[model samples]
Target chain A: MAEPTPELIQRAQRGDPESLGALIVGQQQYIYSIAMSVLRQPEDAADLTQEACMKLLRVIGQYNGESRFTTWLYRLVVNLGRDELRRRGRRVPEMPPMSDDDGEVIDPLQSLADDDRWADPAAVATNTELQGEIRQALDSLEDHYRLALTLYYFEDLRYNDIAEILDVPLNTVKSYIRRGKERLATILASSESEKIQPPRTVAKSDVPVSQPRLARFAWALGRR
Target chain B: MEHCKEYRTNLALRPDGDTAELSQHAATCPECAKAAKRAAAFDTVVQSAVMPMVPDDLTARLLALVPGLAQPMVRSKRWLRQRRAFFAISALLSVIGVAVLIYGLYILGSYVGVSEIWHTQ
Candidate 1:
């Protein structure tokens, strides 16, 4: 992969299309994965990746190169994804618990189960079970936790890089990762073990509480 | 309190703290040991979930969408932004210039005693 060199950055910053293309091609997957992990939707992830690239181009001059290009990109993409998710008024959706006899729901242990391995071909092919489990657990995680885990683990970034990307302190990033892991574990475990637990009622009243004006605008956009 | 505080600090610094003293203490202290084990398990689970190996085409797709490169809309929008900033600065300067002109005229008139003459008239 071609590194984001000073010349390429300069040309891209100057609005050179070729340089921009090279940069985008280089980082598209990284940006897209982050978006997908956060949005949990392929289409939404694609849109955000495109949007982040565009935004990056527009603000390239503002980048002082104080951090790695990838770190800056991570921050940009995650922030956009979070904003997009919030604008859509989509909180973590709850997963249905597994059921036992008598139709009683059980709380499944929601950590990364022994079955959820990225390397296993069988696991990858018939990933419905694992995917569903991950989706459920991830959806239950707070936005910050989701971002931290996605950036740190999925992106294979270091703690300091994640801290830079999330614009948080190093300790804060660690805390987020730790807490996020605990939450995922609890959610996954609870989902697996208590799969028969009854579904909770989701509220329908939509007076738009606590969402910012921009979020309200995005929510309206998301409706379309 | 001191022992508990030291343990908590050690736990926070390195989740996998393997110090002999910490290990012995954890074995003796059920709470610390449980917390340590939980932390270790949590670490393993997170390591597995990240799935760092990205798809091969990810980089290509990313580069394809880069602004001012692949997307015409981005180029257009960037041009529009530059145009907007230019116009905004121009308008601001125009306003400042008008304000300065008014102030200059008022000061010149005052220096020439025009205000006194106007007051008499």
Candidate 2:
């Protein structure tokens, strides 16, 4: 979405109802998208979107225009999302440890070995099932990782903006996104294994010799 | 091997980052090239998955909330004016009521000789 013009923002800040209405109208979809990405439920996301609009109305005057307006707005939405999660008694889950006791970084891609299934850009780009798997994996991730990835990938936000919105350092933002993608790849690989495995009682007629051998080997290796 | 690790790490962290140096390294290394392809694929899938269609009525619903945007300041000013007028009127009435009560007490005291009782005591 295009950023609202400075004139419109100034008018809105001056309490011009028409300008405020226009501003909210322009940003509602963007707000809802972020809310949906965070909440992962249609009803909750919708409620959050409306609530965010109300909040913007109340706090528009407090915006000093030091940062990009959207960045400020994103911080508001993220904070609201965190509050909603807390109200529901769901603490934002902590990111899984990135290093072991030996202080060595655990490389998430180490497990993939020679498996190039996730490495095929064309397959991922065209496959609907893989897209669904990715969405599911994203939903399962911890809040910080999910938020970082959502802002970076979905909103096309820069690392600097994401870092500011997340209130973390630049490197931390990168770590959240990097680890988030790694975790997603891990989840997708496992789900693919489950789908590829056939029943033990399958007849020879049902089995393609080459297909099952490769499937079985990939599945076994993925499990290991 | 360490160079490959750095290349892969950079790819995983930022598939879209400026990678001229990394690209040069990947050109010489088949393993890093494969990793780059995988990172690109993963980034595509993630970008696709994270985007959701905004609800149709979201704009209308949010715009409806805008009417009250300027109302609070207007309403608060009017409220303050009304409250100040109210307090002033109440204070006047209170002063008048107190004076009347004191006058009535003095008259009753004179008629009943209660002031004399106090003076004598």
Candidate 3:
């Protein structure tokens, strides 16, 4: 749960394998989650996590330590994910329509009356199929918004850190979260008459593939 | 109600329990009250779905693959892995050898008038 330390990163750059492994293990979940949010595919997320870590391994010496390691690392990760999206012909950050009054841009989700299901505990909790609905809602969002949402709730990152990682204005990141959440509410709050029909969660036959990894990670760090 | 919209946006950004302003605003304004609930529900759904349960081998697997870590592994861990493999093969061969020897002895006993050797122990 601890952020990668400056000393740990320095040790890794000095070519200590244990330290290197520790650094990647520290952020493995975060990297995978970020990739999953962008790619929306678990296998792809895993692959990206591995790829990003290796990329860092080689390039780590060049890391001038100018920024928090994560901000720099995540920038590399987001770019890789975005590039893959572009290669796949899936446009990232497909911006929603912006409404303006005589010149100033306004929050798009501002106009709609709040949906009923937004607050309905039963609908959210009881809809055994709601996970699919949630994933679909995430899919509908632009890449930037999805990235912000994932970092906010999944990584538990502060908004300012997210802005720095995404290399965007702080206000833009804030707007992205606001709009993304609103869009999700709209999607999840489908009228009872017209339900959303989307793909269900993929069934993973094998799971918790790495309980030992977390343990070993701790073990390796203690070896310092 | 219109000014309450700003409060609703702020309400949505933070988690449900942290902001007292959300409770107060939602109490006075029907819209924010509903927005708060929906936002909470959204948070619940996203958190559950987005969280990753990763493979435990991730770090080990990467360490194995990394160029710097590629230097011959810690001698003891390698020895342990090799020792395990060696024992497994030895046990398998021992079982097979014992079965074959027993069958051969039984065949020889029948031909050499030593049939009693096949009984008792």
Candidate 4:
């Protein structure tokens, strides 16, 4: 497919209906997958995807094409995800005032570090108990780290491209990956208790590699 | 040996060349090797997460979004144009306001000047 050219961008920026329509067509699945990956709710993902696209149309001129168009779109989807998380936080029951002069309760999820908390980090990691902890850990990660790790490992972006998209230095991008991975490893370790076996290694070098089911579910979710 | 260490770190994160050193490391240095193995497993898991058969309606749905996307863009352009026009009209009014204020001040100053001259006479 042709890259989103200057002309296409100009037309879209001007509100050319066809251009706007084409832009949405080109990016809908990507935006939806991004929302699904972060939010883990199909209905919410679909809603965010549409909302992100509409926002993109309204502010298309803000796109300077300095980075790939998709990167900016990813940023939009991520912001929406963050907003959704904050909204959910409000809906969650807060501990009622213990006393008349009671202070605000701190978010327990925010206080704990990533590892030693949740065992599995993948959103679809099957164990329900582990999944809850993992989601909390994921939500706690600073936005850039979460965005970078998701786009890199989950979305399969290279470290360099992520740097470009996030407008951070390459080393910074690496730091986010390393930190995110380490945090995930920690969470998995604490939750699983069993020394998590790497996907079963084949001693016989010739055996085909086995894929983990949780990973498969995540991948399917992304494509959907 | 130096290259091997660097290679091991990368492989520990995502397996690299020569499973032999990594395997040996796993056998002896349990932590390093286990990490390497886990990294490999994680890569497979993430890769699995990344690739899925493209969905059935994704192509059509995406195409459908384009028109929806364009409608607002057009509306926004018109909105922007209106905004600019409003600003321009306001600017013209502002200039007219300043001119009127200056004219009134000049008339008042002339009356004061004439009265002073008559008082001196």
Chain B TM-score against the true chain B, each candidate: 0.38, 0.47, 0.39, 0.34
- Against the true structure, whose lDDT is highest? 2
Q: Would candidate 3 be rated incorrect, acceptable, medium or high by CAPRI criteria?
A: incorrect
> Which run of 10 residues does model 4 chain B get worst, by summed lDDT?
B45-54
Candidate 4 lDDT over residue span A1-224, tens digit each = 32466787788888787877777766665666667656655677777777787678668889887766766767677767777778887332111212211332211122123333222234324444544455555555455545556566544455656666556766666555555555655554555543454444323333334744544454334421
Tell me the docking grade of candidate 2. acceptable
| Residue clash pairs of candidate 4 | A21-B66, A21-B67, A25-B62, A115-A186, A115-A187, A116-A186, A118-A187, A119-A187, A119-A188, A219-B49
lDDT of 2 by residue, A1-224 (tens): 54688899999999888899888877776777678777889889999999998899899999998988888998899889889988999875453433212233334555554566666888878888777777888888777677778788745567788778878877677777777776776777777676777745544565466687754554345521
What's the alpha carbon RMSD for model 1? 23.5
Where does candidate 1 chain A have its weakest 10-residue lDDT segment? A98-107
Which residue pairs in model 2 clash with each other?
A119-B38
Q: For model 2 chain B, give the 10-residue run with minimal summed lDDT.
A: B67-76
Candidate 2, superposed: residue stretches over 4 Å from native: A1-3, A16-22, A93-123, A154-156, A200-224, B15-17, B68-121
True contacts kept of each: 0.25, 0.69, 0.47, 0.15
Per-residue lDDT tens digits for candidate 3, residues A1-224, read 43688899889899888788788778887888889888888877877888888788889999997877887888898888888888889877554433212233222333334445445755776665677777777777667677788877844467677788877766677677767666665665553225445423333432245654444444334421
Model-by-model DockQ, in order = 0.10, 0.30, 0.22, 0.07
How many collisions between residues are there in candidate 3? Answer: 7
Q: Would you list the C-alpha lDDT of every candidate in the order shown?
A: 0.63, 0.75, 0.68, 0.56
Candidate 2: give the TM-score of chain A: 0.74
Candidate 3 clashes between residue pairs 3 or more apart in a chain or in different chains: A118-B38, A119-B37, A119-B38, A209-B55, A209-B56, A210-B55, A210-B56
DockQ of 3: 0.22
In candidate 4, how many Å is residue B118 off? 99
lDDT of 1: 0.63
Determine which window of 10 residues in candidate 2 chain A has minimal summed lDDT: A97-106
